[model samples]
Target: MNPLTRFLSELQEVSLLIWRAFISIFSYPRYYAETIKQMDLIGVGSLPIVLLTGFFTGGVLVLQVFPTLQYYSIQNEAGNSVATSLIRELGPVLSALMVSGRIGAAISAELGSMVVSQQIDAMRALGTDPIRRLVLPRIFSLVVMLPLLTVACDILGLIGGGVVASSIYNQDYHVFATSVRVGISTSDLVSGLIKPLFFGLIIGAVACHKGLSTTGGTAGVGRSTTDAVVIASIWVIIFDFFLSKALQYLLDLGQL
Candidate 1:
């Protein structure tokens, strides 16, 4: 098949998988236990790394911006810049990327292994819907947990930025806090939170699709895991750009 044809075929497959998973979410014999387990794994298991990422990102932003602001004698504005950037863009984007790298790879590997082992086939043979049992819980867990993770990252990022500004830069805590208050609006917070939901969906769908499509053998599982990470990461960035524009447009409409 031509490249375009292959791409279209893959896209169709992924879309169908997402649709099936979505429908399975409301099916009888819901996998509540599995969903909760996945939530804990994806959310709680990811917390330490997420926190570290957010803290360092925030600190680095302050470090990078402080000197420039200082030169302009607007050092106090660092908090506003940091807060607005983190809350509106960096926090969600970075957090999602981190999760895509960590969780996406794991999901793909697990599912890919199951496929390679014929475990998924066996489940189907036993009249168990793998889509409902396995895929739905994962997608739902991510959809629910990603927003919460983003929020945590945002908070840690702000705190990290505040610490750097106050201690390392000798900027007053009150000034930093005031700048953040002035810079961040409800829209910024809402937009940050909103972006991660779509990101989670993308990560889950792409990862699951790659996993389910695994062939060959162990090598294929490895390839699927790697592809899942790369594709999900790329999609996160691509979707973030469009989502930002869409959210801005909606916010503008709300003002009208």
Candidate 2:
């Protein structure tokens, strides 16, 4: 097939997946309940990793950039750059990637196991829709959890950056705070939050797709889980680039 046709066919599959989930959502209250459960599992359960990753990411980012700022005689602007980058990009994307490594793998493993064990078939036999009962909840949970997790990451990451800047670099905390306050805007924060929401959806959907397609047996579950994480991470990076570019363009256009 031509590349154009192949692309269109893949696009159609994605649209159909979204459409099926969208239509099924209206008829399924239980799916929402499962979403809440999954929120705790996917969100609350992943908090430690998220927190640890964010803290280190922020500290490292500040450390790496601090020397550049000092060399440029812009040491005073360290906090502004850190805060702007974290709130506008790093916080959400880093947190999402971290969570995807943890939660995404588990989600795929669980669902793939169900498929392998015929539990999904049992659900079908019982007149329950696996997509609604299983996949939808996960998708919804991810969408909700990722943004909240990003907020936590932003706060924690900024604090970590402040710690490193003040303690190690001898930058004053008050100066750092003021720079952050000046540099980071509500829109910047919101943009970070927005990107992660889509990131969450992609992670969950990709995980579900891999799980639902699992073959073989126990080994298949493991493979599918790994594949889910790999696919989700790649898609997250791709989406982040596009989202960043799109947002930057819109912001520039708006300024005009």
Candidate 3:
């Protein structure tokens, strides 16, 4: 198939997969146990990296913007820059990217291996819908855990900014905190918080689809894993752009 046609086909399959996963939520057996396991794997397993990444990202942002702010004689409002940047963009996007790299790759690899090994076929032979048994659990876990992870990233990023402010810039913590408080708004925070949900959905859907569609052999599993991470990460960024635009439009209309 032509590349464009192949892309459209892939999009249709993933969309249908997402729809089925959503519909499966209301079906019986609910797969609570599988979901809990996935949550632990995707959420808890990812916390350390998220925290570390968030902290460093905040510090770097503050440092990067300091010269510009200082040139404009607004050095005291460093926390304002950090707060808005982390809350509105960096925290959610970066966290989602990280999750896509880690969890996305893992999900695809696991499922792809299962597919290659005929385990998924066995499950289907037993009359269990793989969408309900596998995809839904992963989708549910990511949708629930990603926002929570983003919140943690936002909070840690702020703390990291404060540390940089006090240690490197010799600014007082109270001033930094006050600046962040005065500079941030409810709408900004809400928009940032809301982005991870869609990002999570995109990641889960892409990863699961790649895994389920794996062909060839172990080599195909590796390829699917890599594609899942790259595609999910790209989709998160693409969705983030649209989400940001939509949020800005809503804010302009005083709806958010």
Candidates in order, TM-scores: namely 0.97, 0.92, 0.97
Give all candidates' CA lDDT scores: 0.92, 0.85, 0.92
Off by over 4 Å in 1: 253-256
Q: Please list all clashing residue pairs in model 2, or write none if there are none.
A: none
TM-score of 2: 0.92
State the lDDT of candidate 3 residue by residue for 1-256, as single tens digits.
Answer: 9999999999999999999999988869788889999999989999999999899998998888877888998988899889888989999999999999999999999999999999999999999999999999999899999999988898899899889888988889999999999888988888987899899999999999999999999999999999999999988988888899998888652332
Worst 10 residues of 3 by lDDT: 247-256
Name the regions of candidate 3 deviating beyond 4 angstroms: 253-256
Candidates 2 and 3, the one with greater TM-score: 3
Model 2, 58-129: lDDT tens digits are: 888789999999998988888788888887788888888988898889889999999999999999999998
Name the runs in model 2 displaced over 4 angstroms: 1-14, 253-256
